[model samples]
Target: MQPVVVPEPDGSVRVAGRRVPRGELPSVVASADAGARWTWDDTNRWYPALLAAGVRVERAHDLRLAHRILRRSALASWPEPDAPPGPWDTLPPTPLTAARDEPAMLFPAPGPGDDALEPDPVAELAVQDAVVAGSAAPGRLRLLLAAESAGALAAVEMFHAGLPWLADVHDAVLTEILGPRPRPGERPARLDELAHRIRAALDAPASLNPDSPRDLLRAIERAGVGARSLRKWELERLDHPVIEPLLEYKSLYRLLTANGWAWLDAWVRDGRFRSEYVVGGVVTGRWASSGGGALQLPKSVRRAVVADPGWTFVVADAAQLEPRVLAAMAGDEVMAAAGRGPDGRGADMYAGIVASGAVPTRELAKVGMLGAMYGGTTGSSGQVLPRLAKAFPRSLAFVDEAARAGERGEIVTTHLGRSSPLPGATWHEAQSGAYQDDAGDDDVAKARSYARSWGRFTRNFVVQGTAAEWALCWLASIRRRLWALGVSSSALDAGAVPAPFAGRPHLVFFVHDEIVVHTPADLADAVAAEVEAAAAEAGRLLFGDFPVQFPLSVAVARTYADAK
Candidate 1:
């Protein structure tokens, strides 16, 4: 393939030769070698406009995202020993088109994350490619980058396509749960009644607000209750007439504030809720929503997610994803065999553990495995831990080593080489103070407590992060398969979806280990098949020859809430 450069901010700057007009970008990208991988500073900045302009690429390397991975990855071999780690370490690289010395993208200042053009992105790409190629595990890292880049593309597409939403249904659900919509500056009727009951039972003044935690705590104290806070668990322990009403009030209040009428007005537009998803937002590689709370659609509001006439939603969720992932990554034959089961169904891996006679019961097996992964050291989970250890020692040892490494302030990496974050300077200072000559027992205890707290985080990181990678693979596979499946044969689309996504089965929503596809009714079964096929493909793509499998509970329905 020949290299052709067009340097007019249309993502052809990497080749560094000539300029191309904005209107000509589609033709230029189209004429270039079909297999050429476009190198860009950031996919979010450049790709969106191109996609809006109806241009898509087969392959591309996002330099900023790739650089962030390769530089710190334990699997990569950095050729530049003395290179400064500044600027690139920060999250969300600054936009290329932003003005100098001004607020640009993610961060509001002109430092670290704000400087998008240091060390030359082109040169950085070369170094990263070299390092990854020379790494001990190049294939895993390479697949990770590919999967990550594909995720970036998928995120943009999802944002553009948007999730089909019905404002009327959302309003109906909110009204059913919250009573009539209150007037401006007024509380809902149900919440108001609960607040009154809470104050009356506590013998507080009629004007006392149950929403204010401090005021409610004072009221509880005045009522001869031992509660110091209005937290749910703390309130549950208290035996008071106001406790039940207060808990109910808090629950209704949260739902009203989070996804009530105002949310519908702001988020729902043209029958879609277009959430801007942040790719790799979490440290564990999970996607986070910028607006609309797309990732956390509670069951109360899920009923609002209804497909258009003659269209349906294909919902699928991975079963016991983390444990299945652990089974494959650790290469533990016992756990892998259990994960695969007789029919390659990963249905409740903990149940499989019990059937294998690793533990006495399913509940014990469940908590024991959770304890092993999450560093639980007391209660029912801790009691069953020993039995689980002897049964699946390899998988048990994997997380145990990670936890120990974290306790020593050492960074542990995921299966795909994303390293756990280092403890902050304040954390290090606390640890240092504990080690000093004048340090007391409390200081050391506090330090150890903090270390163990972080240890729990790192211990869960490997499994969760690798599970995230598998999800990316799954999504990418589903996207490809649906694209290959083409439009449904009935040749009708009632959804009235936007261009590019119209007449197509498109991904509408995704949470951890679960996804929903909005498809024409005729293609609903096809989408479900693709979703299940993608899960199996994801398992194979990540584990290769491993016996472990990832299974999905799938449903094709007209509404999101009906899937479960």
Candidate 2:
């Protein structure tokens, strides 16, 4: 390894005494020390010039090592390996090049045709502002900025991949980060009274008969309350003032449904209400709704959640999960190990990297891997990732194979029946025919090719799909546990039933991957334990030890934010 420093160039400063502009300094010379040799294929007429320069280059069948060296050089501005709370969007596309932003060539050849469309710079700034607004406070803003930026970038990637839903989710996330500022003279409405009524409606069945599922359903319907609509009204009323009327009118409709109340009622049956969720259910392999409103929840109703008299709700989720999965697939061991727990000990698999005195947040690991997996050949993540692969072979191999296949215009999948198909004949013809005739409509041909090429858009569907199943099992399992713990908090106790234990609580809410149980403060621990047990059992039921370990880590807090 060599430490070569090039001083910052001034206007018309020389590189090897050839005048260059400022910000462009002496370039570092590098060589591949291992793996496959490297080669360049000039589709853009750079081959003749490079040959003329007498610059030596080698082409290897597997150019992983040489490729990595080139990748590292591109990542010069990335954060240091030990930097705390590293940038999330480390691989964002650079907009300008050279002094005066003129495009300059570092290599012997001019670059290939640029594929990316120039982004609206003004819109990008507004997006950044929104991220700042949603974050907690001034102190927390910087860290959040990086995360939000990365999320936005990931959304862009998804958009390019033809996944509109994921793009929406990321957009929503951006809005959430830059949360709405407090409106003057308009305080949030009190929902406790409404919460009580909704709880009563939710509880009607228990009063009828504890064990009879039929009686419970009938009681629930008879109550004639629209809990879901009430929730919507409450949330809209608190924030978006204009939508209040529509929200209220919508709730009115729920009150009229013969099956609406019954739907809520059935969910609470058998002393437990379980909802099913589907992950990667969408064509782009993102999560989708199935039996319940698992993807969306109205928060006003969230507070009504009371544990069965004695039990408590326990919640947990993996952090920056997909990036870790991608790293593992890429055979970038440094990244996988960075994302993995040291000796597999804690909730954050990347906790090891943070603990080992490298970057702390998973965002760093995420950014590093994202750059490597995508064609972010010139960024910090690209540079650091190859070294990471060298350290962690098994995991890196996974993502590397995926990337290779992707580069070859191949689709790849996990060890399941779900698979990707290759492009049809139309794509092959467009490539060949366009070159023969001078009247080549490149845009039309590319569009046709893209449609045909969609056949090869493979994903590790097994992991994503099965992961969704696991979430469903967890939701159902915890819902059951909470129902068994129901305790009446109301003085009317009108619809309340006997507590599971002498002082246990009841289950109140079931959002995908999360459960809310309203329990007595003292019994919180016991209730939380039950929730944990149920979640673990759910994972076991679905996967049955098929190599990867799906585990749950829990937190017990007074509020939703606190729990997180």
Candidate 3:
């Protein structure tokens, strides 16, 4: 492997004794050794250009992402830079935009005080290397950084490939559900009808708009309906003439605003829907969508995600991911055994819990497990917690310890060392006020409630954060396998599909534990096998030889909705 080469601000690259001119970096990268890994300030800044120029790098070290991990990781002792916070310290991930036709340099030429703001990728990489080397768990920390950087690359590639979408299908679905797109500021025909019904039921005047929450609430109260909020669950329990129409109005309104005709026009282009995927956008290390609501695609709109003529989508969703991760993290073999079937393959862990007599039914087992991980200590969850704890003491104790630590205002680290943020000053002040000499009962009660809430946040943080790490590993592994598979396959015609991913099975969509890979129809089965293999590999990467299983529900379909 060659040493990491840093690109200068003027688009020049300096090798041993040679200088590559501006605008020639792409070709240089394309011809570099396959094993050589590129170290850049941000993958979003550099990879897009390389991909546009028909160039692809096998590996990369994203300094910005690595710095974020080391800055907060409890396992690493990050050395603060000598100068004040630079751009690398505060730089946001560049969002992928539909209109970006050219690549922008990450670090521009400095002028006056701008020198301090300029990021030095070589220095940043050195610092990250040193931090990881000196960390308490160097191996795991290294793996975490690698997976995170790989995820960044995959994110850029997915955005570049875009998700296969049919605008006609989307328009048709919207028209059927909302009764055609509304003109300019007017409501759809169906929404207008539902609004009128709601108004008549509430005995309100025609001027009342059902979209306004305050106005709707006031009208509901005036009509003698016992409703405090417009929430679906809350309204569902009430018996009133207005409840039915009001609920229906709210449901369709959400669909119209979130993924309606306007959204379709702005997001979907050509034959695909391109979304900006923010890696590590969530503190839990989960990805977030900056635009396009890619993470929250409603079921009504999912039917519009259609594959190309000769291609199909291989959708794989991990089953019981967080619980399985918890079982492995706690080294609870008993809990892990529940996820194994008679054939030694992965099975439903909740059913196994029921069979073990931990709970009377599978639903109770699921609720109890969710309660244990999420700090739900009331109602059905509360009722089954004791039995679950008795059955899986180790797993239950693991999250219990995290929750207690949170209540005490201590930071809890995930399995791979992504630590939770510390309690704020406001939280500390509340806790202190409760213990004051003249403190009243209200103060104590308020502090206790605040503590419990923070406890819940931390209780789920560890499990969710670790699950995200597992997901990153899963995506990274699948990405490499897909590239290799595509390179080795001969049946694919590179011209039939989009550039860069013309002949390959490429990842198009990912949310939490699920992923959709667009591939040739003939290779759909192979892609499904690889997706399943990646889950098991992610498990081993995180837990080593732990007997926990990370099973996937794999499906091959032409549309995203049918796969589900």
Candidate 4:
């Protein structure tokens, strides 16, 4: 039977009406039946300890993640609890981390005058079950919950595995670009030189800091550059000597601060850069990093992500994921056909649009599609939108309806039932104020702009959110395939690696649409094949029998930069 692990006020767990001490929880989980799925209040709180104890769980139902989904999803009519602000309603996710030395604190002991009751995971699970069963689309909601829980597992595992990093290589790259590291609160040599050059070019005082936007803007106006801001694009437009050094300073300054020597020391240890990945952190279901900026690694430092000896990195990313998702969601065969190749594999969707004469060039096709999905009503994108709408009316209409729903302050859901948040009270006020008898033109224009901006948000939310679902399914499938591959291969020896994943290919890094698997060099080819198969399976799981292909650009290399 599946077990529901509920944390007690004293940090013990109640399982099957018997109390399991916190110390023995790992062994109990490890001894459960092979097909058992554990339900818990928060996976991050419980699973990390289980993992540290060398116990691996095959399946889970994360109550916190599910509750967030049900409470916001428009398809589910979740009933409010009898007591206002129940414990489950206010429960927060346990913070994620890469440390594995000890079990996470599951629940704090109530102090004097602390009357808050402990949250009951079993109760929350039952509520979620009822909500899902009585919902408009139970199957889809179930799939979403499962995928979300699986994503949590993947997130913890990736942090445990950690990305391979070569500190020496990273140091060399920084030295080459930033002219060596400097003391804290001091600029690097190259940055200092750039600052001096910028000052000379602007004929400004030496005290003027190039890093300060306000100070730099004042200096630029004093120099008669006629620039409004220090933005790169804005500065590039002006014909002035300060432009080049100023831009270079900004670029190097970002690298020095974001991923320079300081970051290397704090995040990387024992040749691994462990970043805490927060699954479903974004409202659209995309991940966010709690620390170590894992999702924003710049190209300048990618060369430092070197695989271990006798191992390689298999990097794969979906090509044009969102647009292709739109095609499938709208059931626009014309749009889908543009991405389908003669061999039944996927091709460049934008290129296919060009071939179909939807737009004259590939660039225009790309811009037009971006405009349609993102609500770009101006510039070159605007000019090409009409042609695209004429060519693919179904796909265009799909987003148009979503945009219109947002304009009227309606909640729009993704294909898998993750709904966009409702417009705030301020939005309602602005909208209502515009219709008042004494409302002026300014009120009307302000309301119109806010409505359009919100429309843009909802228009992209459906496509982007569905694309995130597709990515989550893709990640879960890849994890299963990689584990199975490791289990089936007898020759693979993980003795040199860490426990729990010693003889297995494991996911080390994941961004929105890309994944990097660190695997044995001999299994690189097989891993590549599995990765492709997993992408196909993800498409099938999300859109059964739909011809919208989720083709990936796969590469196997010793380093991340080389893979690209």
Largest lDDT belongs to which candidate? 4
Question: Per-residue CA lDDT of candidate 4, range 1-564, in tens?
Answer: 769987666656778788978768889988889778789888888787777677778888889899989988999998963346666668776765524433335333345544356677777888899999999999999999989999999898887778999999999999998887788899989999999999999999999998898999999999999899878888888898989999999999899889989899989988889888888889999999888999999999999999887788999999999999999999999999999855667899999999898899999999999999999989999999999999999999999999999999999999999999989989999999999999999999989988998999999999999999999999999988898885425434654346577767889999999999988888888999999999999899889998889899999999999998
Kindly report which residue stretches of model 1 are placed more than 4 angstroms away from their true locations once superposed: 1-18, 30-36, 79-87, 90-119, 492-495
In candidate 3, which residue pairs clash? Answer: none
Better of 1 and 2 by lDDT: 1
Against the correct fold, how does model 4 do in TM-score? Answer: 0.96
* lDDT value, residue 384 of candidate 3: 97
Among all windows of 10 consecutive residues in model 1, the one with the lowest summed lDDT is: 99-108
Q: Which residue runs of candidate 3 sit more than 4 Å off their true CA positions?
A: 2-19, 80-86, 98-116, 487-496
TM-score of every model versus the real structure? 0.91, 0.38, 0.96, 0.96
Candidate 1 or 2, higher TM-score? 1
Residue 157 CA displacement from its true place in model 3, Å: 0.5
Name the weakest run of 10 consecutive residues (lDDT summed) in model 4: 98-107
Q: CA lDDT of each candidate?
A: 0.78, 0.37, 0.86, 0.87
Assess the local accuracy of residue 64 in candidate 1 as a C-alpha lDDT between 0 and 100. Answer: 69
Candidate 2 lDDT, 130-187, residue by residue in tens: 4334433322333222222222222211111110012223223323422222244321
lDDT of 1 by residue, 261-326 (tens): 888887787888877777788888888877778887788998988888878889899988888888
